[model samples]
Each structure stands twice: as structure tokens, then as C-alpha cells.
Target: MDTILIVNPKGGSGKTTLVTNLAGYLARQGEMVNLIDTDKQKSSIAWLKHRSPHLPTIFSTHTHNFANFSVKPSWSIIDTPAGLNEEILKKLLKKVDLVIVPIQPSFFDFQATQSFLEILNTKKPIRKGQTSVALVGMRVHPRTITAQQLEDFLKRQGFPIFTYIHDAQIYLQMASKGFTLFDLSPAKAKTHIEQWQPITEWIQNAHKI
Candidate 1:
């Protein structure tokens, strides 16, 4: 099984949104997917409970049993709380195959990711092939300068940013109505469908490495 950790050190960075949709998309693709909600807020778990039972999800609060859980599902996606300390984050990192840090295209979000990187870097040498980090730009406007600047800044900092999710009313609308991306309108569904390709490709490649 492959484990993907979705994390960010700041709230409103689209962590639950990313985790839920990504899990839904992957589960639809026929992979047995298990979602572990480590966030104290339990937002992802609540969302899953409210949504259709088509997707398989498991809500977990204990980080200790996380790594050893019999992840029968081929993919295990973990949604962790924002701003977790180095000690806890390091322990979680050791359990996952890849770490995905979702950040908004804003100075505050960028600054927040710095602390997360610091925690990850502290375990760098020992973490060589054990894990990889990917920066996801969420709720970004198409032509916004902030988006462009964030893209450039992340690149300059040598962070591996793989994809961008545009600011779409469909996401919020669906969430408010207790629906997943699959339940969105056709146009919105198409957008997510297109964006998911590269994300899944990168995930697959990370497992191979």
C-alpha cells in the first residue's frame, strides 16, 4: 500500500478539500483508498460521513496506530492538522510514502510552509527515499500576480510544486451541500478530472521511486 500525507501548517490552506477530492478521485479510479483524518477538527471525517457511501474512508485520531494499521486499501491518504510540531510531524512523515503540502497563493501561506519545510529538512538525510514533498497551489486565480510570484518563489526555493487548482465556486458550493467533486456540475467535474491526471501520475511515480 502507498500512503500519502496531506499537510500544511496553516488553516484555510485547502487541506481538507484537497484530501477529500483526491481520495474520491483515486477511489473512483478503482484503487482501494483509505482516508485517515488526523486533524483534530475532523472536518474530513464529517465530510465523508455526510457524503455518499461510494467512497471508502476511515477516520483516525491516533497517530501512533496510523503506520501499523492494516492498510488493506492500496492507497492510504492522511489528513493532518495544520501547524503540527516537528516531533509529531516527523513521526507522521516516517509513516507515509509521500507528503503533500497544500498552500494558497499568498504570502501568509508561503511563510507558513517554511516552518513545515524546516521540520522536514531536519530529518532530511535519514528521510532520503522514505518520503518526498509536493507543494500544491490551491484556490489560485488565473492571472493573479500573487499566484505567479508564489510559483516563482517556490521554484527558486527548490520546492517540488506539481499542480495548481484554480479558485472555483463549484468547490465551495459542493462542499456546502455535502458533495464531492464527482457530484459537481459537468463543467466543474471536467476541470477536476483534468487536474487529477498529473496529480495521480506524480503519486504513482513517487511510489515507484
Candidate 2:
């Protein structure tokens, strides 16, 4: 199974949004997906509860144990807690194929992400290139100064920025319904779906270690 870890030490960085959508995308593509919620708040778990029976199946276990799954999963998406300690991050990194850090375009978020990235770079798996890391700009408005600043800031970190997801109420609406852009008709979510293409492509191409 391929594992993807969505992490950011800063809270409200859109980690849960990315996790649910990514899991939904994978499930929509007919991949067997396991959703893991490591956050104390159980946001991902709550979202799973809201998932409709007609939608593509995504499995989860309350114990957070990968071995105990309802069905064997081809993909595992882990939503991590905020302020994650180095010891736990290290352990999680060892098992993941990719790490996605989502950040809102704000000064405080940028500062917190910068510090997190510093520690992330020092992890053994990352230093050895065994696991790949990427950034995503969340809740951004296009052609705005804040968006430009986010691009500038992330570029300096020397990691790939897959795409910028704009500030849209659609995400909230979908999340509330246990859905993602991928779960909707193409006509309704074309733009957002296009924005996620790079991320999907990267997931397909990323080597599992």
C-alpha cells in the first residue's frame, strides 16, 4: 500500500481539507483507500461518518492501527495532529511515500511552516530522499498580493508547490456532505479538479519505499 502523510505543525492550516479531498479523489478513481485520523479532534473520522453509502468506499479503524482494516487498502491517507513532536514525525515519515504540508497565505502560518520544514528536512527519510515532500497553498485568492507572497515564500524552500487551491465555499459545502471536488460532476468542479491534477499525478508517480 502507498501511504501519504498530510502534516503541518500549525493548526488551521487546512490539513483535514486536503486529507479528505485526497482520499475522496483516490476512492473516486476506484482505489481502495484507508483514511487515518491522528488528530485528537477526529476531524477525518467525523467526515467519514458523514460519507454516504452510495459513494466510493473508504475504510477506517478507531484504533489508528493500519493492520486492522475493514478491507485491504491500496492507499493510506494520514491526517496528522498539530504541534506534532519530532519523535512521532520521524516514525510517521518512515512509512509514508509522500508528505504534503498545506499552508494558508498568512505571516503566522508562513513562520510556523518554515520552522516545521526545517525539522522535516532533517528527518532521516527526507535527508535520504526515501520520502518526497511537497507544499500546497490553501485558501488563496488568485492574482492577489498574499498569493504572490505565498509563492515567493514557498519557492525559497526548494520544494515543489503542486497547486494553489483558492478560497472557495465549495470545499466547505463538500466537506459537510462528505464529498470532494472529484465526487461531484466534472462540469461543477472542473476548475478545482484541474488544480488537483498535479497532486494526483505526483501521487501516481511517487515511488513507495
Candidate 3:
């Protein structure tokens, strides 16, 4: 299975949003996807409970029983909790093929992400190029100073910034119903889908690397 880890040391950085949406997209494409929630809040797992039977299936299991899946999955997406410790983070980093770090455009978020990225760089998988790391800007507004600053900060971190997902009520609305942009019609979610293009493409390419 291709494993993708979504992480941010700061809370409210849109980790759950990215996790569910990516799983939804893969499921829509006829891939069996598994979601692993490491957050004590269990927000991602709770979202799974709210998913309608009509939508694509995304299987999930507790963090401890990660290898106990009944159905083998093509993709596994992990939603990590905030304030993750170095030892645990290193353990999780060793097995994943990719790491996607999302940050809201702000000073505090930037500082926290910077520190986290430093830690990532020191990991064996990352230093040896066994795991790919990328960044995504969450709740960004184009042409804003903070957004531009965020882009600049991330660019300087020596990792690619796949895309910047703008602030949209649609994400919140869909999450309430256990839905993602992929579940919406093209006309209804065109812009957001466009933003996700680079992210999905990177995942596909990461498998090759």
C-alpha cells in the first residue's frame, strides 16, 4: 500500500480536511482507501462514521491495530494529532512513502511548521530520500500579505508547495455531511478540484519514486 502522512504540529491547520478529502478522491477513483486517525479527538474516524452509504467507502482502524485490515487497501492516509513528539513522529515517518505538511498562513503556524520541517529533515527516511515531503497552504487568500509571506517561508524550507487551498465554507459544509470536493459535481467544485490537481499528481509520482 502507498502510505501518506498528513501532519502539522499546530492544531487547526486543516489536517483532517486534507486527510478525508484525499481518501475520498482515491475512493472515487475505485481505489480501496484506509484512513488512520492518530488524534485523540478521533475527528477523522468520527467523520467516517458520518459518511453516507451512497458515497465511496474509506476504511479505518485504530492506531494500535494498523495491520488488522480485513480488506487490503491501495492507499493509506494518516491524520496525525497536534503536538506530536519526536520519537513517535520518527516512527511514523519511517514507514510512510510521503509526508504532506499543511499550514494556515500565519506567524505562529509558520514558526511551528518551520520547527517541524527541521525535525523532518533530520529523519533517516527523509535524509536518504526514501520519503518525500511536501507542503500545502490551507485557508489561504490570494494577494494577501500573509499568504505571500507563507509561500515565501515555505519555499525557503527546501520543499515543494503543491498548492494553496483557499478558505471556503464549502469544506466545512461538506465535512458536516462526511463529503469531500470529489463527491461534488464538477460545476460545484471546479475551483477546489483544480487546487487539488498538483497534490494528487504528486502522490502518483511519489509512488514511482
Taking all chains together, each candidate's TM-score versus the true structure is 0.87, 0.94, 0.95
- Native-to-model Cα distance after best TM-score fit, residue 96 in candidate 1, in Å: 0.6
Weakest 10 consecutive residues of candidate 2 by summed lDDT: 63-72
In model 3, the runs with Cα more than 4 Å from the true position are 64-72
Query: On residues 1-209, what C-alpha lDDT tens digit does candidate 3 reach at each position?
Result: 79998998899999999999999999998888989888888999988889999998988965743334332477889898888888888778766889999999999998898898999899999999888888999999889999899989988999888999999999999987899899999999999999999999999877666
lDDT of 2 by residue, 147-190 (tens): 99999999999888999999999988987788988889989999
- Encode model 1's per-residue lDDT on 63-124: one tens digit a residue: 44544655557788888887666767767767777888887888877887776666676686
Candidate that scores best on lDDT: 3
- The candidate that wins on TM-score is 3
List lDDT for all candidates, in order: 0.74, 0.88, 0.89
Report each candidate's C-alpha RMSD, comma-separated, in the order given.
2.6, 2.2, 1.9
lDDT of 1: 0.74
Which lDDT value does model 1 have at 139?
Answer: 90
Query: Lowest-lDDT window of 10 residues in candidate 1?
Result: 55-64
Task: Kindly report which residue pairs in candidate 2 clash with one another.
Answer: none
Better of 1 and 3 by TM-score: 3
